[model samples]
Target: MIETYLPNVDWTKMWDATVETLYMTAVSTIFTFVIGLALGILLFLTAPGHIWANKLVNLLTGSIVNIFRSIPFIILIILLIPFTKFLIGTIRGPEAAMPALIIGAAPFYGRMVLIALSEIDKGVLEAARSMGAKTSTIIFKVLLPESMPALISGITVTAIALVGYTAMAGIIGAGGLGTLAFLDGFQRNREDVTLVSTVLILVVVFILQFAGDFAVKRLDKR
Candidate 1:
């Protein structure tokens, strides 16, 4: 009777895999935003005419962000193998995948942040400077607050991208729905497992979009 309903998926294993996938996605997303936000602010401040502007710093930092963002995630996983092992004592689990995801997604998200920040009006910034606002004051009070809507949207997009990255991370033995679907389902020809995993991933994407858009609406004063 139970077999008739759950044919291939062991409920316990499926739940555990779901938890692992969410864990990887949550941890990586938080760190990626933290890193990306800082880097984005730095990039904006260093661009020509901004308070902290420095030609060499902006050039070097922008180049580094571009270099990392340009690499494909699969290649990034392989490249970060040694670093992952060093940080987490092994590179074949969800935890190990965290560093790789953070490194790869952070800069990609950072670029998004830079674009959002750049869209703010120069007049507002000039007004702030004329008012004798400190650099930190302008960033925290003027820039971040004004740009929250765009930042939230950028974060939503980046989070969606990270979901796909987590699946690819499963290729390196990172345990998640992706690992279950790819290794167990594909290898054993278990269509039920594959289908269930795909559906769950889709559901996750939908939830992220809904939650992100909801937040954006609440914060969007205009």
Candidate 2:
């Protein structure tokens, strides 16, 4: 039945592509979360009145995040070709696709992190400070704990965006479902292949969203 409906679909190749896409998304999300979290923390702490407040630092960091975040993902991939090549030794394959994925996503996620952190009650932070809590203590015990729900929610959105980016990267030979869809499906005029790939991508997105929502619900105190 499966073969009859999708005659052109190669199950083996499709599975490989799905694995590659998952690998790229998983690895990139981990790096994006860490780097974005750090960037968000820096932006939050450096902004006017925070413990590490420094107008210059905040401005510079914010500028960098905004600039990178504003660039379209495809353009960002092209722009980062040189850097990706330098870092990964090739601008093709799942590994090569990672730098662009992480770079494009981290800043975006960073903004989300900042938003999440900002939503935390300022009074809690002030109370921590009044009680002689160290900066690190406030960040770990107060800020992160308070903002975890939002932070998880933000990363869920970023991870879904990365799924799309992987497809775009596939246009340039970054192997994944996108590459499979473009090269094997579209280029070869196989609508069945394209349809299958689209279904799989949707499946991945749905799983990520469900997992994220579950985490947020568990973490949310209110």
Off by over 4 Å in 1: none
Each candidate's lDDT (Cα)?
0.91, 0.95
> Once model 2 is optimally superposed onto the true structure by TM-score, how far is the C-alpha of residue 104 displaced, in angstroms?
0.4
Model 1 pairs in collision: none
What lDDT tens digits, residue by residue, belong to model 1 across residues 126-150? 9999999999999899999989999
Model 1 scores a TM of 0.97
State every prediction's TM-score relative to the real structure: 0.97, 0.98
Residue-level lDDT of model 2, residues 1-222, one tens digit each, is 988999999999999999999999999999999999999999999999889999999999999999999999899899999999899899989999899999999999999999999999999999999999999999899999999999999999999999999999999999999999999999999999999999999999999999999999999879
- Residue 39, model 1: lDDT of 92
Q: How many angstroms is residue 21 displaced in model 1 relative to the true structure, after the best TM-score fit? A: 0.9
